[model samples]
Target: MKRAAKYIIGVMSGTSLDGIDIAYVKFNQTAANDFQILNAITIPYGKEWKSALKEGFHLSGEKLVKLDADYGIYLGKTILKFIKENNIEKVDLIASHGHTIFHNPTENYTFQIGNGPQITAITNIKTICNFRVQDVALGGQGAPLVPVGDELLFSEYDYCLNLGGFSNISFKENNQRIAFDICPVNIVLNHYVAALNLEYDNKGAMASEGNIEINLLNKLNSLSFYDEAKPKSLGYEFVSETIFPIIDKFNLSINDILRTFVEHIALQISKKIESNSEKTMLVTGGGAFNTFLMERLQSHTKTPLIIPDENIINFKEALVFALLGFLKDEGKINCLKSVTGASKDHSSGVVYEVESSKFPFSR
Candidate 1:
């Protein structure tokens, strides 16, 4: 089964509702760390699709199941279009990080939509997904799975922090890699920006234009989650039940809310950095694009945040999930117990294969 390289499609849709990220990658079959993103894209979710996923948080029973299958089909067809448009001639596998619908590891349950079998059936390529459940089953937090990627590929940096829907960081501490969510970032910021009938706060301009409310800032800084130990994560439930209510009671304008929250995010993240000998903090994900937020973050810490090229910032998680899927296919451990608190380091993901193509175009 050896080959010079493995061509994989890594797909990711975070809780931020940013979009589905597609990364066509090539990996050295013998050296896992050697990789390249041959092509990548972020397919913005249409209005109807976005609204459906937003409402899916409250769905249950058959409604939830239907959304899962529908999303899988959507992903499958989307990948096919990407392949055609790029004139991609070879694809051995697809590694999809399905959108997180619910992630409450304490309750021993976490679900990501986009069924793997449906993807395999539609695309006729081996598909690997459902990456978090096994770790949760092992009494782990089932979160910050990207740390495995950090340990394997980006170990040169002292810290690998991702500011996606929720902000999470990974770094080597003592001898083991440690990681956990710091606070809400784009997820909280985007929610309030929607109030202004906009998709985002371009360059964080609105946040920079307003004032930070001292009272709101203090309350956000004092949330219990900030003081919690490592191996933690945040979900939409935390925002809907905890963050939004706190911000709404103050009844501040979206500008002020964004301003205060931006400061709060910066402060929480600053608290995590200890002036270390190795000072490079690699920042990635959609939040890295927020100019004002980055400025605020710089003011809070001296660790020197390093934001890589746009491709890495936008699609690192998708790239990592691609690595995770590849590791599983290779029968190597992709989930780390140190980062996830799992029972043991293990490869986690369900792989699906198909014998024939039902897709419109044949390979």
Candidate 2:
């Protein structure tokens, strides 16, 4: 008989650089298609780590290698603390999304740091990390990996839209799962807000106060990425190289920039949430908490937006990475070719096992 696995810890760091979200999930395969999210938590990144990660784009060679190893060590220690604090006893494995540094699938390269060996070495627990490299190597976008989770775990909604550093949406179309990045969200929003000495624009209050710059809004809305086809994704590099320069050219006030950019985000997202027979959309991520952005989305679309409990809103990505790990462990297809434009559907993640006396660890 095949025994069921019960517990796992999933870790994720979004491009927004908001924080590292660690979710302690209890997954049970009740039936062929049903699963449950038992419990979860998201730990905000400290100022020091946040700054270091923000600067990761400029790092290269030895500096990047050292940062990767250091970040891996930090992740291992953090997982240990989370395990002890939660009194979680039956953990099957630790699954991490790591921090994405470079993701240009066009060049056949994508990197997410946080070494699996270091994690297992520190926590003495089986670990699964680096979920994206293989998919990208297979010529996929190496992104929007959460669609598999969205399809299996939250299929109840007509559309699953995640408002993270970048906004991405997934849904069923012609009996196939379709998804793509909508536009930059917190990645650009936070950049400008940080200049005001704020970590984030709480509830988008600052944006709500600022007046929209019509010309800037028009220029932003005209970005070419918006018209791109599905199986696409976005990264920090796009924002730093493309978005920042456009926004900087205006020399506008921070408030005006925030307001106009918020509109741009809302407009881009609204275009993707196409009206359909099914009217309900499930929305999650840090941007979901942005009242102004949400209002803008709601204003433009007739579809009803459903925001679930705080746990689901804040830690859905972390929870889904847990599902990804579970699927990988089961040898089930966790990465979808339809979503990532991979050559084929595949199981992903490099696994590391802890050294244990009773249950021998696998290399």
Candidate 3:
């Protein structure tokens, strides 16, 4: 069977609550790792929605269920509006990495709210989502799902590091993809900056202006998470419980806190890559735009950090989620056992269909 091009709308909302990124991408089987981004936009969350989502992690049972469905509806409506605004008439599928509410793979359960059924009903389009549950059920860390994309699409780079809500790195070693969350990035950074009434420290200027608190930096560097082995991840729970309390005890100014944390991040990340023979590291995600952070990172390691243009930096995860969904659609291996510590490599994600749509690639 000859398959035509796959036009997938990839939607993602990271833990940082930065925004909802929706990318209209076209994938061609014949082109091999080639995909075209026809249209893409990031819709920032309003204050109310942002607060609601931030607090969603604490919601229980019925309230949590309601939040899941409501968030799904929100995502669907947002996707529809994006299509309308972009005049996008053709779409094959919608692949959404819904917002993570609870991610404790140690307990063998992870939840990313935004119900797939609601999305299909609202959009009248086939959708793929809930990508992590199955992997966790298989006794895996159920994270760093982007490694499959890094392997299949961006294999040229020696390392693929994403500086989003969390700093996670992916690379190949011994013919297997190795990846894990290095440290908290925008999630921690944005939380402190919010106190200053700014969404983010512009180009790390505030950090550059302040002196690094050595005691705070040393304590941060000695966190248990850094000493743990790979196949691990971080979540909002860890940040709120472990990180916030520790940082608060110092009573340092925001700039000092930011400066010390940035150094901590750079050190933690550099430690992982310092011994590697591979020298080219492709850096993406929101943190890559932080000039001060990048400078500190570069100073820590001699490895050449390659930052692509704004599009790749901002939307790579959304782009990779699209590829993951595409792999699931094709019944191919979308999750790696080595990277995620899963029992086996498997195609992950729940596929939902809208009856009798005009999708030429319908399975």
The lDDT values for all models are 0.91, 0.88, 0.91
TM-score of each: 0.96, 0.95, 0.96
Q: Lowest-scoring 10 consecutive residues by lDDT in candidate 1?
A: 353-362
Candidate 1, residue 146: the lDDT equals 94
What range of 10 consecutive residues in model 2 has the weakest lDDT sum?
31-40
Candidate numbers, best lDDT first, in rank order: 3, 1, 2
> Which is better, 1 or 3, measured by lDDT?
3
Model 3: lDDT of residue 145: 94
Q: For residues 1-363, what per-residue lDDT tens digits would candidate 1 score against the true structure?
A: 777788899999988898999999889866657899999999999899999899999999999999999999999999989999999999989999899899999899999999998898888889999999999999888898999889988998999999999999998888999998889998889988887778889999999999999999999888998888778878888999999999999988889999999999999988888755458999999999999999999887778889999999998998999999988998999988888888899999998977653777867
Candidate 2 per-residue C-alpha lDDT over 1-363 given as tens digits, one digit per residue, 9 for 90 to 100: 655756888999998887889888877677534555665666788888898888888899999999999999999998899888878787898899999998899888889988889999999888999999999989999888988888888888999999999999999998889889888989999989888788899999999989988988888888888787878988888898889999999998898999999999888878887765367899999999999889998888888899998888999999889889888888899999999999999999999977657756567
Which candidate wins on lDDT? 3
Off by over 4 Å in 1: 1-3, 30-32, 276-278, 356-363
For 1-363, candidate 3 gives per-residue lDDT tens digits of: 666999999999999898899889999887558888888889999998899899998899999999999999999999988988888888989999999999999988999999998999999989999999999999998898998889988899999999999999999889889999999999999999999789999899999988889988888888888889889988888999999999999999998989989999999999998544457999999999999999999998888999998888889999999998888998999999999999999999999998774777848
The TM-score measured for candidate 3 stands at 0.96
- Candidate number with the higher lDDT (2 or 3): 3
For model 2, what is the error of residue 345's alpha carbon versus the real structure, in angstroms, after optimal superposition? 0.3
